[model samples]
Target chain A: MIRLNRLCAGYFGKTVIQEVTMEFLPGKVTVLLGPNGSGKSTLLKASLGLLPLTGGEVLYDDVDIRRLKRRQIAQKAAFLTQSRNTPSIQALRMVLHGRFPYLTYPRHYGGQDYAIARGAMDATGSRQHENTNVSLLSGGQRQGVYLAMALAQDTRTLFMDEPTTYLDIGRQFHMMRTARSLAREGKAVVLVLHDICLALREADRVAVLQEGRLLCLGEPDAIYQSGALEQVFGVGVHRVDTPHGMQYYCVPQQVPGRIAEECQNT
Target chain B: MSSLRIFSTRRSDIIFWAGLCALTLGAAALGLWTGSVKLEPAQVLDALTGRDGTSAAARIVLYSRLPRTCAAMLAGAALAVSGAVIQTVLDNPLASPSVIGVNSGAGFAVALVCAAAPLAQRYTPLVAFGGALAGVLLVAGLSQRTGASRMTVILAGVAISAMFSAGIDTAVTLVPDAISGVTDFRIGGFTGVTMAQLAPAAGLIFVSLGIVFSLSQQMDILALGSDTAQSLGLSVGPVRITLLVLAAALAGAAVSFCGLMGFVGLIVPHTMRRLLGKGSLSLMVSSALGGAFFVTMCDLAARVLFSPFELPVGIILAFAGAPFFLWLLFKQRGGRT
Candidate 1:
C-alpha cells in the first residue's frame, strides 16, 4: 500500500499539485482522471519522489518513502512515464533493464533475470517482438514493451502516467484490460487516464481532479451517479444501461436562457 | 544483489569481436612495417622476437617504430571509448570528444602548462586531464543553467570549444617558445613519443577504461533518458556525473599523448554501434579495437604516403572523417534512431 499525505510539488518554484492526500490500496485499479494540466501526473510523480515534495510525505507500507534509497523504493514500486523515448535496443534487452536494481557490480544479467523479463513480455503481449528493436515497434507495441518493463520490476505497486496515449482504440482497451488483470493479481495499479468512459468502465475506482484539486474519489458508478464527473468536466454526462453493463457518454451543455433568447431573435 | 547478465553471449558478438581483433593485429603489423625505412613482415616479426637485437632493422623497429605504434593504438582506443560514453550520457549521437570541445580543452591546458613551465613536461598529461574535466563541467554546467537539452549540450560544447581554442591561441602568442611544444599537440601525431611519455597516459587510460567497463550497462540505461533511468532505480545524477568524468579522463589521457586526434572517438563508436547493436559492453570493446586499427592505419599512411616528409595524422583523420560524418547525417535523416 502507498499513501500520499498533503503532497505539494511542482517545477521552477511553482506548485503544480498542492495539499493532495490519496491512498493506493493493493488489488485495486485506481485511475486518476483529469483534463490537461490538472495535476494528475504531478501527484503521481510527487508520490514516487521523482519530484521533491514541499509539504508532504509518501508512506509505503507505513514507512516514509523519502527515507528509503532509490533502489529500495524501486523494489517496492515501479513507474512507467507517459513519454516513451524508445531505446534502440531489442525489446527483450530493454525489458531486462527492469531487473536493474537486482543487478550489481560488473553489471551482468543472469539467466533467471532474462527468464523473468521474458515472462513479463509474455504477460504484456510483447513476447512476439522480443527479438526486434523497440524503435521498430509501433506506438502500441512500444507501449506494451514499456508496460512489460514496469511489470518486470516485480514490485508491489505500479504507476503509469497516460499509458494509452497515441495507441489505437483497440490497443487502449487491451492496455486497460492488462492493468485490470495486473490489479486482480494483487498489485496496486495506479494510472492517470484522459479517457473518462474507459476509466468508468475499466477502473475499479476513479479519482477526478480539476485545476489541481481532487473533486471526487469513489467507485466509477458512484462518482457518475453523484454528478461530480459532469461538474468537474463542465459537460453533461449521460449514463445508460445496456447488455454490456452501464455505459457513460458526454454531451455539450446548453446555456440556461440563451436558447430562449435565440428563439426570440429568430 | 542478485547475479545478472546485462549482455548475452551471442554468436554474432563473438564473431564481431574476433573480426575486430584480427583487424587490430593487421593494423599494428602494418604500422610497425610501413614507416620511412620499410622492413619486411618476417624481419619485423624476428625483430619483435629479438632474433638479432644488434641489427639496424631490429634497432629501428624496437626503438623507433614500436613505441609510436603502441602510442597510436592506445590513443585510438582511449578516445573511442570516451566518445561512446559521452554519446550515451548526453543522449546525443552527434556528441563526441571533439564535437563537445573536450579535446580542445585538454589541448589548451597542455599548451598553457607548457608555456608557464617549459621544464615541467612530465606534468603535461595530468594538467591535460584536469583541463578535460573542466571543459566537460563547463559544458554540462552551461547546459544545466540553460535547459540541458540535446541542442543545449551541443551548442554549449561549440561555445566551450571556441573559448578553449582562443585560450590555446593566446598561450601560443604570449610565449613563442611554447609554440614548439604545442605544435605536435595541435596537429596530433606520434612523432617523438617515447616509452616514458606513453606510460603515464597508458595508466590513466587503463584506469578510466576500467571505470567505463564497470558502468557500461548503466550507460545503456542512461541512454533511455533520465526519467526512465530514475524509474529503474538508478540515481541518475551520480551515474551521469561519473560517466562524464570517466569520459573526460579517457579523452584527456589520449589528447595528452596523441595531440587531439579527432574523429576516432566519434567514428569508431558510431561504427561499432552499427555492427554490434546498442549493448554498451560489446559496443565499447569493438570501438576500442576499431579505433586502434583506424589510428594505426592512418598514422602508417601519414608516414608512408609522402615518405621523407610526414603529414600529421589529425589531418588524415579530418579528411576522412568529414565525408563519413556527412554520410551518417544523411543516413540518419533517411532512417531514424
Candidate 2:
C-alpha cells in the first residue's frame, strides 16, 4: 500500500537516507536490517511523513503523501517510534490513544472506541494489565501495551521501530510470532530489528541498508545468500536444517571473509 | 473487565471533584469571614446577601473580602494550570511558570511598563502577557534548536529567569522613583485589588482555562514524547506552542495583579499529579480545585496567622513552595515522577 521512490530524507539540511526505493505490500513482514547509523530509522520516519523529504516523494497507494496532513497520513499508517515516555497513566488509556487518528476536533472517544481498544488489548494479551499503571509495567509488558496500541489503531499498515529491544528471549519469540501473525492477517508489517538472525528468519522480505543506501531487497533467503549481512554488518551467517525447517544464525566476524566460510563448513 | 476498571476510575474522579469542591468552599468562606474586623459567619453571609447594604460589614465584604478572595482563587488556579501545562510541554516535572522564568518575564515587562508609562495600570496584564509569551517562546525555541533533554530545558529556563531578573533590576534602577510600587508588584497580594483591576485578568484566565481544558487529550498525547505524538497525527509543533502561549498568558495575568506568586503552578499540579495520574484532563481539573483551595488558605493564613500584621501572600507560598521543590528534587533522584 506504500511505495518509496528515490527517497532522500534527513534532519536539518543534512541527508542521512538517500536514493532509497522499496514497496511494502500486503501480507508481508518487511524487516529492515542494518548496522548502526544506516538510516533505518530515518528511512522509516521519512516513509511515515515524520521527517522532511529532501528529494523524491513517498506515495500512499498512488498519491504523493505531501498532500496528506499528519492526521491523514495517520489514517493509513500506525507508527510506533523508538523512544516513548512513561507517563503515569493507565495501560488501557495508552492503547486508547491508538483511536486518536480516527477522532475529529475535540477528539472525543465513545463506547465503541473503548470496546475496540479492549479488543486490541485482548489481541496483544495485555488485557490483564489494562488497569495497571504503564510506568510500573515490566519492559516486556510495556512493549505489549505499545503493541496493543498499534493494534488498536486499526490501520492497514503498522510500523514498529525497534520493537524487540528490551524484550527477553521468550518475549522476543512472542513478538516475532505476533508480527508474523499480523502479516498473515494481510496487514503490511514493516519493522526495524538489530538482530540479523531474527530479521532473516522472520521476515518475508529483507531490506538491508548500508550507510544510508539500500544494499539489497528480496526474499529473506536470497538476501542472506547474497552475503549482504556480512558486507553491511561484518557478520558471519550460516544456515542449518532442523526438523521443522531451515534456520539461520549470525555472529560478528572481526575478520570478515574466512570466518563466514568457516562457520558454514563447521 | 476493562469496563469495571473504567467505572472505578470514573467513580474516583467524581469523588475527587466533589471532595475538592467542599474543601475549596470551606477555604473560601474562611477567607471571606476571617479578617481584622472579626466578623461572624452570619455577618459574612448577610454581607454577601446584601442584607447589610453599605454598612461597615457590607463594605468590607464587598470591597476587601470579595475582590481579594476571587483574586487569590483565580490566581492560584491560573498559575497552577499554567505550571502543569508548561511541565507537560517541556516534558520536565521541574518546568513551571515560575521556575521557567514565565513570572520573571511578566515581572520584567511590568517593570518596563512602569518605567515607560506609570499611568498604564490598565495595560499591565497585556504587557505582561506579551513579555511572558516572548520569554517562553525563546526558551522553547532554544530547547528545540539544541535538541534539549528534559533537564536541559529546566536549566535553560533558569538561565533565562536570571537574565529577566537582571532586566527587572535595571528597570527598577533606571527610574527608581517612577516605579515605587515595585515591591507591591514583586510581593503580590490581594489586599487593595479593586474589582476593576481583577476583572480583566479574570477574563484572560477563564479564556485560557477553557482552551487548556478543550485540549487536555491532545496535551496527554504530547506528554508521550514528540515522535509518538507526531506519529499519532498530532500537530505537535503548533499544539505545543499554543499550550506554552496559554501558559504564559495565565501566568502573566496572575503576576500582573498579584505579583509573582512563586510555585503555585509547580506545587499544586505536581501534588495533583500524585493524587491523580498524568491524565491531563483530570490532572488539570484537580490542580485547579486544589490550587484554589491552597492559595485561598495561604492568603487566609497570611492575614490571620499573625493577626493585626498581614504578611504578603507570596511570603507564605515561598515558605511552603521552596521546601516542596527541594523534596521533589529528592524524590526525583530515581529519575521518575
Candidate 3:
C-alpha cells in the first residue's frame, strides 16, 4: 500500500498538486481522472519521489519513502512514464533492464534473468519482436514492449501513465484487462486515462480531480452516483444494462431547458 | 533483485571482435617496423627481446619508435572509448571530445601549463585531466540546471568550448616565450616522445579504461533515457557524472601529450557503431581495437608522407576525418543518434 499524505508538489514550486492525499490499495485497479493539467502525472511523479515534495511525504506500508534507496523503491513499485525514449537496442535487452534493481554491482544478468525477460515478452505478446530493434517497432508495438518491461520488473505495485496512448482500440482494452488481472493477482495497479467510459467499466476505484483538488474518490459506482464526473466535466452520466453486463455512458449536456437525450440503455 | 542479461553475444559478434583484434595487431606490428630507419620484423623482435647488445638500431627502436607507437595506440584507445561513452550518454553522435570541447579543455590546460611552468612538463598530464573533468562537469551542470535535454547539452558544450578556446588564446599570447613547442603541441604528433612522458598518460588511460569497461552494463542503462534509468533503480545523476568523469579522464590523458587531436575520438567510434550496433560492450571493444588501428595507420602515414619533414598526426586525421564525417552526416540525414 502506498499513501500520499497532503502531497503538495509541482515544477519550480508552482504547486500543481496542492495538498492532495490518497491511498492506492493493493488488489485494486485505481484510475486517476482529470482534465488536461489537472496534475494527474504530477501527483504520480511526486508520490515516487521523482520530484521534490513541497508539503508532505509518501509512505510505503507505513515506511517513509524518503528513507529508502532508489533500488529499494524500485523493488516496491514499477513506473511506466508516458514519454520515454526509444533507444536503439534489442527489445529483449530493454525488457531485461526491469531486472536492474535486483542486479548487484558489475550488474551481469544471469540465465534466470533471461528466462524471466522472455516470460515477460511472452506475457505482453512482444515475443515476435524480442530480437528486433526497438527503434524499428511500430507505435503500438513499442507500447507493448514497454509494458513488457514494466511487467518484467515484477513489483507489487504498477503505475502507468497513458499506457494506452499509442495502442489500438483492441490493444487498449487488452491492456485494461491485463491491469485488472494483475489486480486480481493481489497487486496494486494504478493508471491515468482520459477515456472515462473505459475507466468506469474497468477500475475498482476511481479518483477524480478537478483544478488540482480531489473532486471525489471512492468505488467507481459511488463516484458516478455522487455526480462528481458530471460536475467537473459537465457531462450526463448514464448506466445501461446489456446482455453481457451493466455498461456506463457519458454524453454532453444539452442547452438550457433541454433534457439529456443521447444517453440510452442497451 | 533478479538478474537479466541486457545484450547477448552472437556468432557474428565473435567474428567482428576477432577481425578487429587481428587488424589491430597487424597495424601495431606495421607501426613498430616502418619508421624513418626501417627494421625487419625479426630485427624488431630481437631488439625488443634485448638480443642486439649495444646496437644503434636497437637503441633507436627501444628509445624512439617504441615509445611513439605506444603513445599513438594509447591515445587512440582513450579518445575512441571516451567518445563512444559520451555519444551514448548524451544521445548525440556529434557530442565527442573534440566536437564538445573536452579536447580543447585539455589543450587549454596544457597550454597554460606550458606557459606558466615551462620546465614542469611532467605535471601537464595530471593538470590536463583536471581541466578536462572540470570542462565536462561544467557543461553537464549547466545543462542539468536548465533541463538536460540532448540539445541543451550539445549547445552548452559548444558554448563551453568557445569559452575555453578563448582562455587558451589568452594563455598562449601572454607567455609566448615559455612555450617554444606550442605549435607542435597544437597539432599533435609523437615525434621526440619519451618513455617518461608516455608512462603517466598510459597509466591513467589504462585505469580509466578498466573502470569504464567494468561498467559496460551501467553505461547501457544510462543510455536509456533518464526516467527509465532512474525508475530502474539506477542512481541516474551520480552514475551519469561518474561516466562523464571517466570520459574526461580519457580525453585529458590522450590530449595531455598529443595536443588536441580530433577525429580518432569522433570518427572511430562512429565507424564502430555503424558496424557493431549500440551495445556498449561491442561499441567499446570495437572502438578500442579500431581506434588503435586507425591512429597507428595515420601516424605511420604522417611519418612517411613527407618523409624527414614529419607532418603532425593531427593534420592527417583532419584531412581524412572531414570527408568521412560529411559522408556519415549525409548517410544519417541529420545525425540519427
Candidate 4:
C-alpha cells in the first residue's frame, strides 16, 4: 500500500497540492477525478518522488519513499505520464530499460530481462508491432507500448496520468481493461483520469478532488451518487440503474444567452 | 525460420560492418603509400615494418604521411562519436560539437592563448580542452532554462560559435603575425602534424571514447525522454552532464591537433545511422571507423587535388559534407508529412 500524509507539492515556489492526504490500497484500482489544474498529475508525480514535496511524507508499506534510493523507488512503483518524448527508434528497447534497477553499474540486459519484457508485451497486447518505430505507431498503440514498459518493471504499484487521453473509444476500453486486469493480479493501480463515466466503470474506489483537496474517497457506488458527483462537478448528475449495474451520467447545463445567440445566428 | 535462425540473420550486418572497416583501413593504407613522393606498396610496407632499403622513403612515410594518417583517423573517429552522442543526448540530429560552438570555443581559446601569452604555444591542448569544457557548460546553462529544447540548443550553439569566431577575428587582427596560423587552425587541416603534437591529443581522445563506449547503453535509454529514463531508474541529469563532458573532451582533443575539421562529426554518424541499424554499439563502432575513413580520404583528396601545394582538409570536407547534409534534411522533410 502507498500512503500520502499531508503531502504538498508544486513547481518553483507556488504550491499546487496543498496538504492533501490519501492512501492507495494494494490490489485495488483507485481512480482520481478532478477538474483541470486541480493537482491530480502533481499528486501522482509526488508519489513517485519525481516532484519534491514541500511538507509531509509519502510511504510505501510504511517505509518513506523519499528516503529510498531512486532505483528502489522504481523497483517498488512504476510511473507513466501522458507526455512521453521517446525517440522512435528506441521504443521497444526502452521497454527493456525497466529492468535497470536490478542491474549493476555498466548495466546490460540479460536473458531474464528479455523474458520479462516479452511477457509485458504479451500482457499489454503490444507484441505484434514491437519492432515498429514508436512515432509511426498510432496514439493508442503507443500508449499500449508505454503500458507494456510500466508492466515490464514488474512493480507492485502502477501510477498513470491520463493514459487514455488521445485514444479512440475502442482503444480507451482496451487500455482500461488492461488496467483492470493488472489490478486483478494484485497490483495497486492509481490513475488520474478525466473521463468520469469510464472511471466509474473501471475503478474499485474513486477519489474526488476539488481545488487540490480530497472531497470524497470511497467505493465507486458511494462516490458516484447523484449529489456527490453533482457537488464535485458543479452540475446536475443523474444516477440510473440499468440491467447491467448502476450508471452515472452528467446532465448538461444550458447557457441561455449563448444558445439564443447561436440560434439567431443560425 | 526458428528464433535462433532469425537471430543468426543479423550475421550479415556484422559482416557488412567488418567489410566497411576493412575497406577504410585499406584506404588509409593507400593514403599512407601514395603521396607527392610516392612509395610502392612494397616500399611502404618495408618503411612501416622498419626494414632497410630507402631511408628517404621511410622518412616521407613515417615523418610526413604517418602522423597525418594517425591524426586523421583519431580526429575522424572522435568527431563522429561526439556527434552521435550529442545527437542522442539532445534528441536532435542537428546537434554537433561544431554546430553547437564547442569547437569554436576551443578554437577561440587557442587564439586567445596565441595572442596573450607566450606560454599558450607550449600548452595548446590544455587551453583547447579548457575552452571546450567552458563552451559546453555555457551552452548547457543557456539552453537548459527553456528545458533544453532541440531548436533552442542548436540556436544557442550557433550564437556562441559566432561570438567566439568574432573574438578570434579581433585577436588575430591585432596580432598580424598570428593571423595566418590562427586562420589555418580555424579552417581546420592536418598539414602541420608531428608525432610529438599527435600523441597527447590522441591519448585524450582514446580515453574519452572509452568512457563514452562504457555509457553507451545508458545513452540509449536517455534518447528516450527524461520521464521514461527516470521510470527505468536511470538518473537523467548526471548522465546528460557526463555525455556533454565526454563529447566536449573528444571535440576539444581533435581541435587541439587538427584545428576545426567540421563535417566528420556531423556527417559520419548520420551516414552510419542509415547504413547500420541504430543499435548504440553498432552506431558507435561504425561511426568511429567511418569517421576515420572520411577524414583520411578527405585529407588524401586535399593533398592530391592541389598536388604540389596543399589545401586545408576542412575545405574539402565542407564542400562534401554541406551538400550531403542538405540532401539528408530534404529527405527527412519529405518523409515527415
Candidate 5:
C-alpha cells in the first residue's frame, strides 16, 4: 500500500496541492475525481516524487518513498503520465522502456524483457502497431501503446493521470477495462478521471478534490450517497442501476437561472 | 501455454544496416580513388599493400587522400551522432550541435588555444572538448534557470551561439598569425590534416560514440518526457547532463579537427529518422554511417567540383542543410497545433 501523509507539492514556490492525505490499497482501483485545477494531477505527481514535497512524505509500506532509490521505488510503482507527446519511436520499443527498473547497465533488453513487453502489448491489444511509429498511431492506439508501456513496467502499484482524455468512448471503455484487469491481478491502480459515470461504474473507491482540498474519500456508492460530487463539480448527479452495475449521469446546475440573471443584468 | 515473444525488429532493419555498410564501403573507395592524382584501382591497391615505393602518386595517396578521407568520415559520424543525441535529449527535432551552440563553443575554444600559444596547438582537441562542455553547460544552465522549457533552451542556445561567435571574431582579430594554419579549419574543410593530427580526434569520436550507444536506451526513455522518464526510474537530470556532455565531446572533437561544420549533424540524423525509423540505437548507428558517407561524399565533391579551385565542404553542406532545417521547423509547428 502507498500512503500520502499531509502531502504538499507544486511548481516552484506556489503550492498547487497542500496538506492532502490519502491511501491507495493493493488489488483495488482508486479513482481521483476533480474538476479542472483541483490538484488531482499535482497530488499524483507529488506522491511519485515527480514534484518536490513541500511538507509531508509519501510512505510505501511504512518507508518514505523519497528515501528509496529511484529504481527501488520504480520496481514497486509505475506511472502513466497524461497523454502528451508521442515520441517517434516504435510502439514495442516504447513499451520495453518500462523494464528499466529490472535492467542493469551494460545489459540491454534480453529475451525476458521482450517477453514482458510483448505480453503487455498483447494485454493492451497494441501488438498490431508494435513495429509502427507511435507518432503515426491514432489517438486510441497511442493511448494503448502508453498503457502497454506502463503495464510492461510490471509494478505492484500503477498510477495513471487522465488516461482516457482525448480518447473516444470506445477507447475509454477499453482503457477502464484494462485498468480493472490490472487491479484484479493484484496491482494497486490509481487514476484521475473526469467522467463521473465511468468513475462510478469502474472505481472501487473514489476521492474527490475541490480547490486543492479533499472534499471526500470513500467507496463510490458512499460518495454518491453523500451527494458530494454535485457540490464538488457544480453539477446535479443522478444515479441509476443498469444490469451491469450502478450508473451515474450529471447535468450542469442552475444553467437557466444563471443565464436569466445575466440577461437581466445586461 | 502460449509462447512469449518480446522485442522484435522488422526485416527492413537488416536491409537498412546492410545497405548502409555497402554504401559506406563504396563511398570510402570512391573517396580513396578520386583525389588530384586520380589513382587507378590497381595503383590504389598497390599503395595499400606498400608494393610501390615513395612515388608522387603513392605519396599523395598515402599521405594526403588517406587522412583527409578518414577525417571527413570521422567528423561526419561524430557530428551526426552528436546531433542525434541532442535531438533525443532535447525532444526537439530542431535541436542540433550547431543550433545549440556546441560547435561555436568548440570553435571559440580552438581559437583561444591557437591565440594563447601556437606551440600548445596539439592540445586544441582537449581544450575544445572542455570548451564545448562549458558552452553546452552554459546554455543548459541558463535554460534551467529560466524554465528549462524546449523553447527557452532553444532561445538560450541561439543567444549563446551569438555570444561565442562574437568571441571567435575577437580572437581572430587579436591574433591574425594564429589562424594561418587554421584557415582551412575555419572554413570547415579537411585540406591538410596529417595522420598524427587526425588520430586524437578519431580516438575521442570513437570513445564518445561507444558511450552514446550504451546510453541510447536511456535516451529513448527520456524522449518520452522528463516526468515519465523519471517515474520509470531514470535519474533524468544526471542522465540528461551526461548525454549532453558526451554529445559536446563529439561536437568538440569534430570541431577541433574540422572547424564548425554544420548541417551534417542536423541533416543526417533527421534523414536517418525518416529512413530507419526512430529507434535510437538504429538511428545512432545509421546516422554515424550516413554522416560518414555524407561528409566524405561532400569532401569528394568539394575537391572535384571546381577542381583546382576547391570549395570548403561546409559550403556544400550549408546549401543542402539549411532548407531542410527550415522545412522541419514548419512541419513541427504544423504537427503541434
Candidate 6:
C-alpha cells in the first residue's frame, strides 16, 4: 500500500499540489480524475517521489519513501508517463534494465532477469514484437512495450499517467482492460485518466480533484451519488442504471444570461 | 533452455571479435608499410620480431613507424569510445568531443602552454589534459543549471569553444616566437611521435576504455530517456556524470597526443551503429577497432600522398569527415519533428 499524508509539491518555486492525504490499496485500481491543470500529474509524481514533497511525507508499506534510494523506490514501484521514446535498437535491452537494482557493479543480466522480462512480454502480449524496434511500432504496440517494461520491474505498485492518451478507441479500451487485469493480480494500480466514462467503468475507486484539492475519494457508487464531479466540472451530470452497471454522463445545464451572450456572439 | 540460448548467442559474438582482429591486423600492416623509407612486409615483420634486417629499415620501423602506429591506434580507439559514451549520455548524435568543444578546449590549453610556461612547452600533454577537464567541467556546470536541454548544451559548448579559441589567438599574438612549431601541431600529425609519448597515453587510454567497457550495460540503459532510465533503477544523474567524466578524460588524453584528430569519434560510432546492431558491447568494440583503422588509414594517406612534404593527418580527416557530417545533418534535418 502507498500512503500520502498531507503532501504538497511543486516545480521550482510555485506549488502545484497542496497538502493532500490519500492511500492506494493493493488489488485495486484507483483512478484520479481532474480537469486540465488540476495537479493530477503533480500528485502522482509526488507520490512516486519524482518531485520533492514540500509539506508532508509519502510512505510505502509504512516506511518513509523519500528516505529510500531511487533504485529502492524503483524496485517498489514502476512509473510510466504518457509517452516515452528511446533509440529504436535499444528497446528490448532497455526493458531488461528493469533488473538493474538487483544486480551488482559491472552489472550483467543473468537468466532470471531474462525470464522475468520474457514473462512480462508474454503477459502484456508483446512477445511477437520482442525484437522489433520500438520506434517502428504503432502507438498501441509501443504502449504495450512500455507496459511490458513496467511489468518487468515486478513492483507492487504501478503508476500510469494517461496510458491510453493518443490511442484509438480500441487501444484505449484494451489498455484499460490490461490495467484492470494487472490490478486484479494484486498490484496497486493508480492512473490519471481524462476519460471519465472509462474511469467509471474500470476503476475500483475514483478520486476527484479540483484546484489542487481532493473533492471526493470513494467507490464509484458513492462518488457518483455525491455530485462532487458535477460541481468540480461545472456541468450537470446524470447517473443512470444500465443492465450491466451504473453509468454517469455529463450534460450542459444552460444559464440564461451566459447562453444568450454566447448565442449573440456566434 | 535459456542457458543454451545464451550460450549460442555468445557463440555468435565470435564474429564481432574476428572482425575486430582482422581490422586491427590490416591497420597495423598499413601503418607499418606506408611510412617514409617504407619496408617490405617481411622486413617489417623481421623488425617487429627484433630479428636481423636492414639497419635503416629497422631503425625506421622502430624509432618512427612503430610509435606512430601505436599512437594512431590508441588515440583512435580512445576518441571513438569517448564519442560513443558522450552520444549515449547526452542522447544526442551530434555530441562528439570535437563538436561539443572538448578538443578545442584541449587545443587552447596546448596553445597557452606553448606561449606561457617553458616547462609546459616540454610537457604539453599534461597542460592539454588539464584544459580538457576544465572545459568539460564548465560545460557540465552550465548545462546542469539549465536542466541540460539538448540545444542549450550544444550552444554552451560552442560558446565556450569560441571563447577558448579567442584565448588561443591572444596567446599567439603575444608570443609569436615562443611557438615557432605551433602551426604544424595545430594541424595535427604523427610524424614526430616518440615511444615515451605513446607509453603513458596508452596506459591512460586503456584505463578509460576498461572503465567504459565495464559500464557498457548501464550505458545502454541510460541511452533510453532519463525517466525510463530512472524507472529501471539506474541512477540517471550520477551515471550520466560519471560517464561524461570518463569521456572527457579519454578525449583529453587523445587530444594531448594527437592534437585534435577530428571525426574519428563522430564517424566511427555511427558507422558501427549502422553496420552492427546497437548492442552496446558490440558497438563499443567495433567503434574502437573502426576508429583505429580510420586513423591509421588517414595517417597513412597523409604520409604517402605528399611523400617528403607530409600533410597533417587532421587536414585529411577534416576534409573527409566534414562532408560526411554535413550529409548526416541534412538527413537528420529532413527527418526533423
Model 5 docking grade: medium
Candidate with better TM-score, 4 vs 5? 5
lDDT per residue as tens, model 4, B210-250: 98988877887787677777877888889999998888889
Q: Which residue segments of model 4 deviate by more than 4 Å?
A: A88-92, A130-138, A226-251, A255-266, B1-9, B328-337
Q: All candidates' lDDT scores?
A: 0.85, 0.88, 0.84, 0.82, 0.87, 0.81
Error of 3 at A240 (Å): 5.0
For model 3, the superposed segments whose C-alpha errors exceed 4 Å read: A234-266, B1-9, B327-337
| Fnat for candidate 5 (0 to 1) | 0.76
User: Considering only N, C-alpha and C atoms within 3 Å, which residue pairs clash in candidate 3?
Assistant: A102-B1
Q: Lowest lDDT 10-mer window, candidate 6 chain B? A: B178-187
Residue A121, candidate 5: C-alpha displacement in angstroms: 1.4
**What order do candidates take by TM-score, descending?**
2, 5, 1, 4, 6, 3
Give the per-residue lDDT digits (tens) of candidate 5, residues A1-266: 89999888888898888788889989999999999999999998888888888888899888998798888888888898885677878888899998988888665889999999999999999988887899889878888888888888888899999988888888889889988999999999999998998998899999999888888999988999898998787799997878967778988788777889989999
lDDT of 5 at B37: 66
Kindly report, for each predicted structure in the order presented, the TM-score of its chain A compared with the true chain A: 0.94, 0.93, 0.93, 0.92, 0.95, 0.94
Interface RMSD of predicted model 1: 2.8
True interface contacts retained by model 2: 0.73
lDDT for residue A25 in candidate 4, whole number 0-100: 84
lDDT of 6 by residue, A216-246 (tens): 8999878877888777777787768899787
DockQ of all models, two decimals each: 0.53, 0.66, 0.48, 0.51, 0.61, 0.56
| Candidate 1 regions with alpha-carbon error over 4 angstroms | A104-107, A254-266, B1-10, B179-183, B330-337
Docking class of 2: medium
Q: TM-score for every candidate vs. truth?
A: 0.94, 0.95, 0.91, 0.93, 0.94, 0.92
lDDT of 2 by residue, B1-337 (tens): 6688779888987888899999998999988988988888888889898788778988888899999999999999999999999989988888898888899999899888888898996998899999889788888898889998777888889999999989988988988975545676676677678899899999999999999998998988898888888878899999999999999999999988898788899999989888877488988888888989999999999998898888889989989999999999888876654
* Greater-TM-score candidate between 1 and 4: 1
The prediction achieving the highest TM-score against the true structure is 2
i-RMS for every candidate (Å) is 2.8, 1.6, 2.6, 2.2, 2.2, 2.5
Please provide, for model 5 over B64-97, each residue's C-alpha lDDT reduced to its tens digit, 9 standing for 90 to 100: 8889889999999999999999888777777888
